[model samples]
Target: MAYQIFFREYFQTPPLTRAYTTACFLTSLAVHLDILSPYRLYFHPTLIMENLQLWRLITPFFYFGDFSLNYLFSMLFTYRCCRMLEEESFRGRPADFLYLIILGCVIALFFAWFLLLPFLGQSLTTMFVYIWARRNPYVQMGFFGLFVFRAPYLPWVMVALSVLFDGDLETELIGILIGHAYFYFEDVFPYVPGGWRLLATPRIFKLLFDGELENSDYHPPAEERPAGFNLGAQEEQANQQQRNEEN
Candidate 1:
């Protein structure tokens, strides 16, 4: 009973038991297969041990980085994306967000491994998906070095840099795209009410509500307004004062 409770809290859902376990198993299998490849038993691609099809299903959802810096940044970015979806989506339950991510990763990986890697040299689809999703207008990744950008466009910018600088961060980039599409489709059509939608709605609401509450110029209608002074004039005055300070 005690062990069950501990497991429940620590290795709860999503990648904890499901995706994480699957990834470790696949990686292990890949290593073993690689060892036996010279015997001509295992599939050739699997022997190369570079994002095999089996690993496709879980690798994108797992931490690709073993080192601290990369691992930390990946976790931070992934967590923020998950948190945003969790709060913003109406259709997504906590489990659903993970489900979409896992599902998307798997789908993208399959295409990359089976369809692309055999011909294209790598699975660029994963990278493409992340770039596309982070481009969503609603998303905004926080401050980076000297520049702060809205989330949706951030992924694309990184991809551009990736192309320019020739970094191998494409898989992580793909993860973002997979995460994004899962949320979008989940909201627009919504076959599963309890999935990704859960993350998008309230999360987006919080962002919008925070902005609304902060901006004085955008007044709720007289009947709709939160209890306070006239919102319009207050916002105008605030803006004027800001401009004055700038001068």
Candidate 2:
């Protein structure tokens, strides 16, 4: 019984987020099991360009490292950011959320290629965190039960944590740059005077992923059948008094 309930809830996770988080988990698990190696996963331009190793472009964003406390925390954070962004900020707009993911990936890819970064799993998670933070600026979050701050400061705090713990900021900083660029173009520019929406989600994407679910065959219960926006809704049912019976 519990297993069935768990399966139902797991399948009900927002589709895009479920796919993304599942991919990240499987990638890391594959590495942990020795079925895959980091050497083939990390971003390397030369291997991609000359050797036609195209998978390098994708694997880096999913493979974080062996299982550890940090790895577990990063995955949880990634899942939370993605699920919230889909279920709240981008609610009812799956296509727009998809466009956001594609745009962020492209920007992150260019930066990773240019900077010769090996892995971007953490960086991609950071970018999602940054965007979620920007859109939800008023939500308060605590850091290791030490201090609490608003959502707007979350990304920078992560960067500081990275520096303090790992002594590295390159990957997280790259993510911040990509996140800010996307936030400005999508959220800020559209509202400015003499500005236009440069980051609008494409029409085809809406046609593909934004389909609305409806039940055209459904019939209203007899009690509510007579009320609607159209004239036909007033038609008498057997349960109602006929017109001839009225005074």
Candidate 3:
């Protein structure tokens, strides 16, 4: 029962969120079990171009380095941010959320290929974080109960922390840039007097994912007319009797 409650509360989420988190954990488990080498997962242009190893495009987004405390924390953070974005900002709009994921990954791939960067897992995680932060700008957040600040600064803080620990800002920066560009186009730009929506979710996607019933008057048929009920016949007989009395 406890395990059932845990699964219902934590594991159950919208379709995209569930798929993403499951993929990340499954890939991480494969890495931990030594089924695949981490070296093969990182983004490498030569492998992709000459060998047509296109799986590298997506594999990089699943690996979060060797199993450790950092890996666990990264997974949790990714799950949390993804859940918030999917359930809150993109609520009832799974297609739009999926579109954001595709867009972010495409932009990250472009940068990773050209700049010779390797892994993009952290970058994609940061992109989700950046989007959530922007959507909830007024909400207060803290880093491991240490420093507290508004939501908008969360992505920058993560980048600074990454620089402090790993001395590499490439991934985080790319993620932030991509996230900001998306947020600007989707949220900020359309609100401008002369500006129109720049990122329209495809109609096919809306039909596929957002097909909630819109008919307010719709209702289920009455339960099987209670075993041969004949109210219609009785009403017709009464009408005929009233007509005969009037004549």
Candidate 4:
């Protein structure tokens, strides 16, 4: 019972966020256990093309290099932002959230394959963070309680911090651009003249993830009435009095 409560409280992440974080942690564990090699997971066109190792396309977004302070920070940030976006913005819309992830992955893979970039996990994380930050632009956030800023600047701050850590700016920049493009089309451009939703999640996907097309009719279950209330008896007495008056 305690374990169930604990899980319901702390580990009750949205489905997509939970799955993504679990994949990252499992991949990291495999690497730490020497069961998997990071070299085999990185995105390399030559290896993928000639060797036909297509898994490279997906694996690169699971491993965040060897375990270290940077890796831990990246993982935590990814999990937090992804959870926030899924729960707050994409509430009760798992298919829409999944579509966003698919879009981001496709864009990241494009850069990795064409530009010969090796890894993209951080970039994908940044993309999620950027979108979430943009959606909540007026919200104030702080970095380890050191520097406070509005939500929209959070992604740029991460880029600057990445440079400080000697990380590649290209990956982060790609993520930011892709995130901005998605935000513009999905949230902004739809209001423009002759513009329509370009990132619609298919009806099939909606059915699969969300179970039904309409959620506006949702209602909370009523609480059980306390024992010995006897409202039925009171109603019966009132009805009897009304009949007597009518007679």
Candidate 5:
């Protein structure tokens, strides 16, 4: 009963975040215990295509190198950022968020094939941070409680920190590219004259996850465009719909 309460509080709601973070933690534990090796977990394009080691495609996104202090930091950041994105921007829209994850994974794998970067779990984390930052541009972020900065700069700040600490820059650079590319198409381009939302979440995803809002935002009106970045493009409209349903 006590354990149930604890879990209900700590890991309650934001089901996707709970699942992802749990997978990351368990994968790290398995590696630390020698039950699984990092070698088998990395994304190897050649091995995947030639040898049919297809698990590598998804496995690498849940691993953040060998377990260590760096691993701890990366895992914590991923959980916090991912949960915030789900709770705020992706609120009540699990399918759309899942679509983002799937799209991001495909794009990551494409880059991995070209660049031959083996591991990319941390890269996904950085990309999530980028999107969250972009969405919550005005929110203040504190680092180790040492300093505060507006949210939009968070991804760049992390890239700078990674370089400062002799951390690998390739993963972060790739993440930034992926995040910004998605942001442009999803948020920015749709407002342009004669432009449409490029990656509208498919109806199948809605059936599986949302069960409503099949074509949530083919194009948002101009009046709402200004607040879309921070509050999520569909959030207000969704909330109003929910209220209307209740009324």
Candidate 6:
């Protein structure tokens, strides 16, 4: 099954399709095998032991931690994010998607080595991608057999909850820093007005995503959005202003 999912021809294209399919397959396998519980120990005691090996790069990603409802939600959430990014052409680019995974792995490696931090698995990274791209708040998803409105602050709310309650989940939190850096470096850095420095200091996420560049931010301005300058909106405002002038 692993061989079929990873190497099959039908799973080749559409980056998100490929990713979500792979994640789902892994999650299913982990659940069925019941190895999920033992795998999560990589982030805690087993990881700290001497002579850490290279396979740890992909180990945390398999950390199911628990087979409970919360873990299922994480799996579904990751699939949703993978589908979303796969829908985007930029993310579909083979080089770019590969770059993102590589970028994520590098960040994980840095944290594990220099900081003595526990390796965060990919769960937070998936959530971060979903949150950053969630421009629309009207979306909904079923939770525990009940439908719920998508809250705009869900991502931050998750972050706060994780911080307050997930003292044991160090890898998930620190993993987001890596995810943010990966996304910002790949997608946001290229468009910045004078961000050529990113090429020189590619790994310095603080300079890239932080407030250091607000004065030079180059994102498209508000008035230029499709909704902002629609004929109806502008024309109505213009007529209202003209009527006031006449009065």
Residue-level error in angstroms, candidate 3, position 178: 0.5
TM-score to true structure, per model: 0.43, 0.81, 0.80, 0.81, 0.85, 0.55
Q: Residues 58-161, candidate 2, lDDT per residue (tens digit)?
A: 88888877888777777887889989988877777888888888887777789888888888877777888998887665467998899999887998887887
Name the regions of candidate 4 deviating beyond 4 angstroms.
1-10, 214-247
Instruction: Quote the positional error of residue 79 for candidate 5 in Å.
Output: 0.7
Q: List where candidate 2 sits over 4 angstroms from the true fold.
A: 1-8, 212-247
Candidate 3 scores a C-alpha RMSD against the true structure in Å of 17.3
**Against the true structure, whose TM-score is highest?**
5
Residue by residue across 1-247, what tens digits does model 4's lDDT show? Answer: 9989968855678778988988998999999999998888989988888999999989989998778877887898799999998987778888888888988999999987778889898988899889888766546788888989988898899898788887778888999988889887776665457867677778887788888777522221222111113335544665787799999
The whole-model lDDT of each prediction reads: 0.42, 0.77, 0.77, 0.81, 0.81, 0.50
Rank the candidate models, highest TM-score first. 5, 4, 2, 3, 6, 1
Q: What TM-score should be assigned to candidate 5?
A: 0.85
lDDT of 3 by residue, 1-247 (tens): 9999978976678778788888888888898898988888989999998999989999999888777766776788688899998987777678778878988899999999789988888888889998888766556788889889988898888777776666348888998999889877776666557966687776666667677524311111222111113335544665787799999
Model 5: how far residue 130 lies from native, Å:
0.8
Q: Where is model 1 more than 4 Å wrong at Cα?
A: 1-60, 87-92, 115-142, 160-166, 169-173, 176-180, 189-247
In lDDT terms, how accurate is model 5? 0.81
Clashes of each: 35, 0, 0, 0, 0, 2
lDDT of 5 by residue, 113-213 (tens): 89988878778888899888876665667888989998888888878877876666898888888888888888788776797878888887888788886
Q: List model 1 lDDT by residue over 1-247, tens digit each.
A: 9999967854544333344334433443554556422123222346447644453333333423233443344344444444444444312244434444446655555545654422111122333334334323433345567676655565665556446544445454554555455534543323334533333324343344333323222212443221222446645765788799999
Give the backbone clash total of model 3. Answer: 0
**Model 5 clash pairs?**
none
Q: Where does candidate 2 have its weakest 10-residue lDDT segment?
A: 222-231
Query: Candidate 4, residue 235: CA error in Å?
Result: 52
